[model samples]
Target: MNAELHTLTGAYALHALSDDEREEFERHLGDCEACTQEVRELTATAARLGLAVSVTPPPEMKAAALRRISTVRQEPPVAPAPARPVAARFRGRRMARFALAACMAVTAGSAGVAVWQHQSADDAQQQARAAQQQSEQLAGVLAAPDAKATTGQLAGGASGTLVVAHSKNQAVFVASSMPKPPSGKVYQLWFNDAGTMRSAGLMDPSQTTEAVLLSGPVDKASGMGITVEPSGGSPAPTSAPLALMNFATA
Candidate 1:
């Protein structure tokens, strides 16, 4: 894409581009990752700007403006005049109105940009907080005095370990040497509380050695199992478990 086309990024992000312009920019976006990321950031910013409160015009404002316009005489067509500087053409009220309009346009655009920046900052802060919370949870689990770890062999030569914090009703699982599931299928973890089985979470197929934070109540669970299920996972195990580990928790 041409350098000149890059200038339209802001307008494109704001959805101000014409149809043809937008189509061309979209094609350019596929090849240009930088531009694609910029557009995404600007679009998010625009969304934040849209949430701002707006002032309503007075009820009679439109009628009064139309009446004033009706009273003004239309100018007659004349031969083309020599080009003059924009500042040199307007005088008195016309000049004031033009300046005021220009100022308002600039202010509005700046305000929108400002709102986008503020929202971006807020999102970063929220992500940071979430990361900190996750770290703290993991630390607490590792530090538990009664936590026990056990390893067992799974089907297809896979091996897995389970670390449980019985008193805290929490557990983490780490799997290795697991075969990839068939297309449209994923491995899911399950916890057996008494005789009832409940889903924990799905395993990451891409990682040979992966750790997962198990869900459901661990204190009441007598055992844990793993089974292959459809991609989104199943409410109940669809097939026989490939691995099962019984826990004797206090």
Candidate 2:
């Protein structure tokens, strides 16, 4: 409920709490946001901790678990055996028990490995999906009929084909033949998404034609503009546009 208790909540969730302290924090967690965040962070930390220590619970559980396994295991029917065969049968049973224990250990180890692999896979998938969603969003804007509003020429510049695209979201400015930006000076791009104007990017002029991507949410793009700006980019155009391409979506 309060910061002190909230901090203890983290310890509680992670099993780092003393018995009484644990009870106190658990009782308080019903209403605390700070506690909730800490609990969430600690839960993640605990999951990692759990993998570090794989001690099985209690011996009583092992007995019950073994009994459950025996109930499920199919035992071969007993047969009247010669005296020599009786010893062999006992040995065979021992071997089977040892093999079962071996199998269980292997299974548990495999499951632990599988869980870590699954998490890593899920993380990679999440990143890939995010990238794909962004690219798709960009593609939809690029493929829109509105994009034909203006024609971008791919000229044989000193760098490569100077291909450029423009839209309301922003101008997709790129130049292949252009040379890289000077040591400190960078090429900047601009777009009039509506009446509002904004600088697009500060990039190496030489690599400009390589079609670098930009994230935008833009409007009423009347013209595409490029300028020389400092590294990274600027929010607004500080200098004259080096190149201008005018286009209309309507």
Candidate 3:
């Protein structure tokens, strides 16, 4: 078995071989069990890869490739001469195909990276917009003519202040030196709606000192409370309140 022809399994699997080379390889495949097995495996892998590659390479990468191609000097025309040996021609074409495959792999990697970068940028933008909206709502509540505040102390020297604006029907909860919740738990805020407690919002686990705009209307609630609930929070308080503040007295 020719080692050179054995190597052609890759080119054949990729359909990179010329018609004559393909015919020769196919004829060779009849007697070569190893190459037959290799070709079968390579062909399956190529089919799988063809279906997987859908991301379009960035435009800048295409432009750069075109620029590189433009810079390559074309070989000058030569007087008619004897043709090179078929083996030598195959070897040269094989090397060129290998180079092309390497380039394609790099381009594919770049496409993946570009997709990740775009996703990161989109995530950052969404976070920024949310922050801006929260800030505006906080400002509206804090500056309301009827704005009032009620403060309460927690067990671990932590404190929370609830600011309510009856005119705006909005409320904001500010925490300072807040301790981390127990493992598998989170801090949840609630409004004392008449006698029933209604969920306001949950505090971010990552922040120790931060302000949150409570969810839903605050006009009916006469007080606010904080409690430790399971992760993702419960619809109702699962335990006693860590701290409570009376909005009616404030």
Model 1 alpha-carbon drift over 4 Å, by segment: 1-132, 248-250
For residues 1-250, write the lDDT of model 3, one tens digit per residue. Answer: 5556756766765767889998787767656655554444344334324323423457799789889998999999766437966666577566666555444434322111111122343444444345435655766676666777776787799877777888889888777667889888899999998778999989877556556779888867888888999999999999999888878444
Candidate 1 TM-score, C-alpha based? 0.48
What are the per-residue Cα lDDT tens digits for candidate 1 across 125-199?
444344334434544454466666677888879777677777677877766566888888999999977766799
Q: What TM-score would every model get versus the actual structure?
A: 0.48, 0.38, 0.51
* Winning model by TM-score: 3
Q: What value does the lDDT take at residue 104 in candidate 1?
A: 36
Model 3 bad stretches (over 4 Å): 1-119, 248-250
lDDT of each: 0.60, 0.45, 0.67
Pick by lDDT: 1 or 2, better one? 1
